[model samples]
Target chain A: MINRKSAAALIIGDEILSGKTLDTNTQTLAKHLVRMGVTLQKTETIRDSVDIISEAVKRLSESHDMVFTSGGIGPTLDDLTYEGVAKAFGLNLLKHEATIARMHEIQPNLVLNEARLRMATLPEKCDAIWTGGLWVPLVCVHNVYVLPGIPRLFSSMIESIPSDHFGDVPPRERKILWCDLAEGDLAATLDKAAKEYDVAIGSYPATNNDSKKLYRTMVTVEGDEADIVIAAAEQLKGALNARYGTV
Target chain B: MINRKSAAALIIGDEILSGKTLDTNTQTLAKHLVRMGVTLQKTETIRDSVDIISEAVKRLSESHDMVFTSGGIGPTLDDLTYEGVAKAFGLNLLKHEATIARMHEIQPNLVLNEARLRMATLPEKCDAIWTGGLWVPLVCVHNVYVLPGIPRLFSSMIESIPSDHFGDVPPRERKILWCDLAEGDLAATLDKAAKEYDVAIGSYPATNNDSKKLYRTMVTVEGDEADIVIAAAEQLKGALNARYGTV
Candidate 1:
């Protein structure tokens, strides 16, 4: 079966909104998806509201091929990922016997709080995969995979997911070149090369705080084909060298 | 005059999409707007596309009370913020004579790389304020404000925005409490207190990493009134303590 290509990530938390924390999951997931040959089209950060989470899940799942949500899956009252996922899929959340059993194995002295047990509840019609060392399963709803908000846990959970689970992994490559020349000085040449190679070129400039006189510009070339990507990168490096004497 | 509340934030970069960077600007702006009594209900993140940036500006300005964009204001090829803002407002991206003069004054020996000077270009219809330091101008388009992506710079830029410019600020009375009790165990108490006090309660549960025996529950109480917020918070604390004892 030919799987769809688009994906989206929803990061749920009030901490993110409050500027109390910086979210790393979205970027990590986006890069992972890109490598998987999936196009990450949209990313949204929403407050921990069941209504909002449910709405976002339903809408994104319907529109995109895959949807990944991070955060709000803990045992606290603010963790409403399970409830939201259930509501989104119109499924009843019941504690899974297997998950409860696994929890006991992981923590023999674990005191079963009703809130913590909430983590064991999975939406109907979904398969759950345990991420990291956590005993609770990361529930997968349709094409939506719910992961924890913790960066370490999120990374581990993403790794646990088989590449083939999403679909065929497409070949993607990136090359970077650093130059002392400014971007505007190379805009025309870079734009011309980008069009010619059908590649994407991203130029980032940074000022050296130490010297205050020297500036470094990094140009990134990315595409699906290795030959095209390498060729475009070489072209960019050559153009930069010709335009501005080599550093 | 009853000034309507509106605002927008622009995030410009490929780092955001590539998952190399998680944007904290939206959340920061959202919370700030909420504190300022500005209804920040919508936000979008787009690449460093001049066309996309211009279109975002036009649409957001037409609907929102204000628009604030973070990123794409740098001195790189991807930094299309100035041109984008100009196009959106049908203004010319000309070197602001005053701003250029200030730049020369601040950094006399500054090799005005056309790229570095790119930072001085501003839309004709907007006012510019120096945000990062003495030379960088924070361009303001009507109600829209353009900011840099660097966390410190973004925060400083926002702080420099006078509250009077945005009309009445949002009420900032909010309180938080931690409970050892599970959310489901205290659901009834929380719901009853919320309804009685007419306040909003958000519960977040986290698993204990060390013991994994008890789940840490964080309850947030928010309202327009200080007394009501405190009262609700007290009720939640009392109920959780009664049920599961103190944390």
Candidate 2:
């Protein structure tokens, strides 16, 4: 049996907490995960403190099907994500010879300072996915995938991760149409449509300058099959239109 | 005594959970609060659910010295922040006559939909701080300031919030410079610096392409006072430099 339930993103870095960096990774991952039929339940940002990072890693790893941690894997003293992650799984940070060699290959002229080489350290028994660069190394520990915090690198590394390795869940296509209708007014109709189609319907309202304001309701219907989503969306649109006219 | 310690940000939106919009409000507010000498301890994101919104409002209002809320105060069905906040405080959501009059003055040709008019409603006993378009009315609930989620609007509203509202506490800053040192190698020193300063000092390492494999270390000292921070930074920098010499 395949676990098809939960996912989480643990963003690690002082830059996040200090507000020096805005976390785009959480949103990006959340959207992507949802598209992949994975429910992203929570996203947390913890400082680069080892205790906090370790605790977060342990808790999230145990609870979620997969955990993606971004940031704090750099060659800096403040970069404690690797060590914290290693400690979380009770693994020693051993130098992975292949990773070091890859690092050298990418930047042959690169200095091999102990700090720079630290990027090659991985938890024992962990699978290191080398999206190699001067930035942090992306590695997978248990169900957790650690990537760099830099938005560009983070996104690229995430894309490089094979979706099959995470799980073989069917992709779900979700779409939304907005309307100007009071939630209370549309609640019963939406409920009927939801029950009829066995789909979830969310009704939200948006007000406007006219006393006859519009509700920007998002009627999202999702399923493994594109036809199912489209059919549900059409039903909702028709019901809403019948009541409020063209939105 | 005025407690000038804790601050919080309330992210109000259904779109956030629906995955329609990525929240930048929390990050922006957190950064501002940190720089203003206020410790941003918690952030809450709630949907347009009235009960949840009200509960969050009451709880967070009582907990933090300053609270910044973004989204859901717009003229839309999903925008129920004003009503929820009013209910949370057990106050009436009365249309501020002045605000209504102002709205009328600004958009005389504008149709006054009940939903749009709802935007002018204010919780009794709260102060209103107008930000952005003359047509929109933004307000504050106790220490909680309600702002729109549109990046520009949110930022503009933030400007109206008095900077000195949280009072003054000096921020500590420390800088560290080390060459050819890995974080693990300097763990003991880093721990000592943190203990000595009775604050947080972060270590960041950067790699180079030198023959000696040089790495630059960034030690950040954070405290409530400048002197203690500078002293700790100087001590750590001196020790590291003496051990490794300048790169």
Looking at model 1, residue A155 earns an lDDT score of 82
Chain B structural similarity (TM-score) per candidate: 0.84, 0.81
Model 1 regions lying over 4 Å from their true place: A1-4, A75-77, A83-98, A108-114, A181-189, A207-215, A238-247, B1-8, B27-43, B50-64, B82-95, B110-121, B178-193, B205-218, B235-247
Per-candidate interface DockQ score: 0.32, 0.16
In model 1 chain B, the worst 10-residue window by lDDT is B206-215
Most TM-score-accurate candidate:
1
Please provide, for model 2 over B21-106, each residue's C-alpha lDDT reduced to its tens digit, 9 standing for 90 to 100. Answer: 67787777776776677777656556566787788878878987877778777654456888888888888888788788777888
Candidate 1 residue B200 C-alpha distance from true site, Å: 3.1
Candidate 1: docking tier? acceptable
Candidate 2 chain A — worst ten consecutive residues by lDDT sum? A205-214
Q: Which stretch of 10 consecutive residues in model 1 chain A shows the poorest summed lDDT?
A: A206-215
